[model samples]
Target: MTHAPSPASSDRFKSFSEFYPYYIHEHSNQICRRIHIVGSALVLVILATAIITRNAWWLLAMPVVGYGFAWVGHFVFEKNRPATFKYPLWSLMGDWRMFFETVSGKRRF
Candidate 1:
C-alpha cells in the first residue's frame, strides 16, 4: 500500500507570502477563525506572563494552548486537518498574521 501526501504537504510554498492566501481560505469558517484568534492571544499573554514572572513552564504550555483550540476548530468546525502538521513555519506566520488581521479590522472575526 502506498500513502498519498496531504494536499498541504504536496504544495511546497517558497515563501510565507505565497501560503497566506491558502491559509486564509482554510480558516473560512467564522467560529474556527475566531477560535484561532483567541488561541493566539492566549499564547501571547502566556508568553508575557512567563517573561514577567520568570517562569519558563508557562512557555511550555504555549503550544498546547494554542494548538488545542486551533485543532478543535479545525476538527469540529472546519472538518479539516491543520496546516501546521505540514507547514510549521508558514502556519505559525499565518496564525499571527490572521490574528493581527482580525485585530486590525481588516478581516472580520
Candidate 2:
C-alpha cells in the first residue's frame, strides 16, 4: 500500500496520477470514504434531477451537498484537513474517481 503523504509535506503534485495514491491514503478511514461515496452519489442524483426537470436550482445545491458531507467525514471521522483546500480541481476529480472505484468494487466500500 502506498503510504499517505505527511500533512506537512510541501510537495506539489504535477499530475493526477501522482496525487491519487495520496488521495486514497487520505481517505483510509472506512466511514470517511463511505460518507464521500454517499456525497458523490447524491451529487449525481442531483445532477440528473436538474437535467431531467430543467430546474437549475438543484444545480446550486451540488457543491453544498457534496462538500458538506465530505467535510464532515474529514473533520469528524478522518480527523484530517481536506486536500481540497490545497488542490481544488484535483480533489474534485479524486472524489469522483474514488466514488466510482468504490462502487465498481475496485476499492473497498
Candidate 3:
C-alpha cells in the first residue's frame, strides 16, 4: 500500500534559512521553547565538562540530556513529534540557533 507523504516529508527545505522558520513554528509553545533552551544550555555544559576534565564518558550524556528535555517539551507541552526525526541536521542547527537567539534577546525565552 502506498502511504501518503508525511508533513515533514512533503515540506522539503532547501536551506537552513528556510528550515528555521518552520523550526520556530514547531516550537511556538512558550514552555516548549524554554525547555529546548534549557536542554541546549545543558548540552553546552556537558561538552565543556567533557573537555575540561578530559573525560570522554561525559560526552555520552550530552545527547541524552539535550534530547531528553527537548523530547519532553515536544511530547508533553507541544503535543507534537520533534522536527529532529525528519530533519536531523537542520534540527540540531535550529536547536543551537534558537538557544542563542533566546539568550541574546533576539527571541523570547
Q: Which candidate gets the maximum TM-score versus the true structure?
A: 2
Mark the 10 consecutive residues where model 3 has the least summed lDDT: 1-10
Tens-digit per-residue lDDT, 49-74, candidate 1: 99999999999999999999999999
For each candidate, give its TM-score against the true structure: 0.88, 0.91, 0.89
Instruction: Itemize residue pairs with steric clashes in candidate 3.
Output: none
lDDT of 2: 0.92
- Clashing residue pairs in candidate 2 are none
Candidates sorted by TM-score, best first: 2, 3, 1
Candidate 1 weakest ten by summed lDDT: 1-10
lDDT of 2 by residue, 31-108 (tens): 999999999999999999999999999999999999999999999999999999999999999999998888999999
lDDT of each: 0.89, 0.92, 0.90
Once fitted onto the true fold, the runs of candidate 1 whose alpha carbons sit more than 4 angstroms away are: 1-10
- Candidate 3 steric clashes: 0
- Give the RMSD in angstroms, all C-alphas superposed, for model 1: 5.3
Model 3, 28-53: lDDT tens digits are 89999999999999999999999999
